[model samples]
Target: MDPAAEGTTTISPQLAERAERSDLHTLGIEEEYLLVDAVEPRAVETVDEVIDQVPEQMRASVQHEYLRSQIEVASPPQLELSSLYDSMRVLRTTLADAAGRAGSRLVAVGVGPASGPNSRLVDNPRYHRMRERFGDLSPGQGSCGTHVHVSIPDDETGVQVLNHLRVWLPTLQAATANSPVFGGHETGYASWRSVMWERWPTVGPTPYLQSHEQYLTMIADLQASGAMLDEGMLYWYARLSASYPTVEIRMGDVMPTLDDAMLLAALARGLVATLVQEVHAGAVAPDVPHPLLMAAHWRAAKDGLEGTGIDLATREPRPAWRLLRQLVDYVRPELERHGDAELVTVLIDRLRTRGTGAARQRALLAKGTPVAGVVDWLARTTRGEM
Candidate 1:
């Protein structure tokens, strides 16, 4: 019998069982950092050397990125927000110390502030193939980001969450906007990395999917198209994980501080949990138009939190903070369920008062600080020394 016709769906038994056992709002975080010359403060091709110095226990968690100057560290799935924060702090401190010992510094900025002609590709076959295929578009691909994964029951629920969560992704991007300066020039857009990243054909808001079968079919179609290299290259802002039973939110820039990264994770978890509960309660996913969603994403990328964001529901302009508050209210129940309500509130308040990382960088520049000073500040802030 057809699984869909039987109302059982196409989920594998293993996936269904794992989903049943999964803890809602369980978190996993992946952050990419750029290695820069300690004194000169420019992106340097030293990830290979720095990875060798990582502790043996963390070797598996730390991995190379597409660029030679970049390293990405991932945390095991975490159940508590505080534990996730602690794990990230340890990883950042360890990686920074290792990079410092190797005469480099790890900067968590979204894009390399001083990336120049010297940046090189990581010596990997896949990266080589990408460069060969993409040509000029592949050389200057050193942008970094923070990916947040929230556990869900199964692919069916995951697809539903993805559809419901699409409208709020722009708000998340605005909250974590950090990449203002790239290649030593003010890019005008707050998160310049967002602009750079969307150059890939598949890296944007996904279409509203009706089922797990539809999601898989879409991936299959994209892979069949020569535009995509593989299923792994489905770099949508949010998607069901290819290797894990979680919905991965990939819209935010690499936040400069551990606090910012944790804030993003908390919000992501809350959003996913809220959506799952709604699905259980028979709420249909919002049928928002794709172009409007893409426009919202573009507005968020261009303005960040400094300006207006497209209100997905109204399809009208609104203050970024106002939209952000709407998101918080929408997910407040989930936040409370996870004991993260107060923490998220406090973090959002702090972000408003201190401004985002991009705003902070602009403030330094406004005070007549050089680009190098901005880079130095980012390095110190990322290391928790500032």
Candidate 2:
């Protein structure tokens, strides 16, 4: 049956509820990207051109983001990691082919690697309204990243999961760090997104909360105080999504390839599952270090994996490799049980060596090629054409 064409009245609420409550592994990914042209250096305004050209099966998964130059592709809920790779590959190929037909290409990057004036690339009503309201706060119709969501059984579990997931988020951020340049200038920060996104009215790390009641109070206060326009503005480092029965982690940059994206998603699912089970069994896992979260995030934004991160337990800075070892040990049992042990090993190897996206971008720059060259590099990376 065609999913989009299916009438809303035909859907079963009970079945939907069961799907949300299921304890098995469930994962979803939303990846945002920059639309570029092989001959141009600025943001390429071409969503309509490519959308009109892609096949129907691929078009269903592809859509526009806040900006015209930005395209977001989200995978449907999946029970296994391999299925995610298949969907991602198909959508990416279709989009790339469509862009090619339009005399342009799609590049996945967290920030526009090169600078261009803020202008509408695609004409969408909500995007126009958002730009009008947010003013300069809106990165002005450019930049992109990957957001991962894993199902939670209930609100209580979601809140606790968000709180506990904080410490590991920086590591994930470091692992996927990709944005290094902005406006044609080499932003010293490995992930300048940390600076760019702060312009938004409500965004940043989730503060330490005592319990679920406290989390609710914080949200209510934000709404009342106007710090947030709505519940959507409570953009913590990681948070229980208001609309989805899942914990959403927005720490990572847009990965350049499907393999990296899937690896991160699988790891995220394993972490959430392991932690939720522990919480349900009345087992107290380790406490999150908000201070560590602050410092680690700083290092990730500054050095990617090239620099060391803070060890909250030891109160000292340690190399990313050392920190990653501790983290792998912490999550090894869960990875093994879920048949994702291979991915964990691959990620650990990457962590021990080069940094994630940011490192690759930096290397590409050192070669004396233009930022457009880097975009091309990322395209090849994601398409396995590298």
Candidate 3:
């Protein structure tokens, strides 16, 4: 049966109990971007200088990442999708203008073509300690990602949402796979950033937890093991935000356009809302094995939407579009609830036709556009000028 046509199921006891208190679908987005020379498109170490150029009023929204060649911007929590888009656009335009004044450009690609051997760590004691502890994984680490935070009522609901959401995270990764090139070479994966990110000990798909107690215990164990710096370092693809009352999905590469980013945010918020509804309707989370989930993630990272992805329901190879459609169908009710169904449908159609960021980058290279030209295109598209 087509999951999309299915009628609403009964609300579970847990969901029914908290329906009155839940926020439903409030969202916030955070994106990291690479800073590069405006003319040459090479990664540049100027975050400190660029941050100074941002207007005083907007200063708090823009921040430095671990790498000096990278910067991050966050949108204030918003209930309307349009408000989120406007916030992102204003931040991007302001940051781009500031970078321009500093002879740099803010490129939204996953990793800069000029990154690798020369990447510099930001001048901070925390970053210094990370470099000292992680060693090889610390250097040459210049990649960016989009994180979506969807509000939940409390930790118990957040854990259930994470469990239900894990199976679909790979599909999310494939849809947003924007990091095709890294350190000046095509990495043969749509999201080379995922590969680069997995090198960190704490990153990847997390195991299902039975309760909030289990979640906290697991985090405590990881922290005690010295592999993690603290609770804030729990870098699973999705996790309860250490700083917010939301489940943060951190699986997407920084998208090439505002539309792409908003598409991701919409889907993320819809997924959270759908899962919350499922919990209330008394649906049990799927018992997908952790290893199989990891394999699906690897395939999505390897092929993106241009190739096949693992179907979580069957653990078999399926076309990427088919998996995406199933995901949409599964969350259709929630999408409609939040008024995102039309926007998501249109954006998915566009992605299917135009290809993902990796595919787009390859197309440019195939057309005899130099790597620098590719970077310029990404910068222009990021600013919504192209």
Judged by TM-score, which candidate is best?
Answer: 1
Better of 1 and 3 by lDDT: 1
- Tens-place lDDT digits, model 2, residues 222-255: 7787666556556676887665677878777888
In model 3, which residue pairs have backbone atoms overlapping below 3 Å? 10-281, 11-280, 11-281, 12-280, 12-281, 12-282, 15-280
Which is superior by TM-score, 1 or 3?
Answer: 1
User: Backbone collision count in every prediction?
Assistant: 0, 3, 7
For candidate 2, the TM-score is 0.88
* Candidate 1 lDDT trough over 10 residues, lowest sum: 1-10
Q: Residue-wise lDDT of candidate 3 within 111-221, one digit each (tens)?
A: 776544567887777667777887868446477888888878789999999999988999989988888887777789899888888998999887788999999999999
Residue 325 lDDT (model 1): 91
Q: lDDT values of the candidates?
A: 0.84, 0.71, 0.83
The collision pairs in model 1 are: none
lDDT for position 386 in model 2: 64
What digit string (tens of lDDT, one per residue) describes model 1 on residues 220-273?
Answer: 998788667777778889998877778989889998888788889999999999
Q: For residue 340, what is the lDDT in candidate 1?
A: 93
Q: Give the candidates in order of TM-score, highest first.
A: 1, 3, 2
| 10 residues in a row with least lDDT, candidate 3 | 1-10
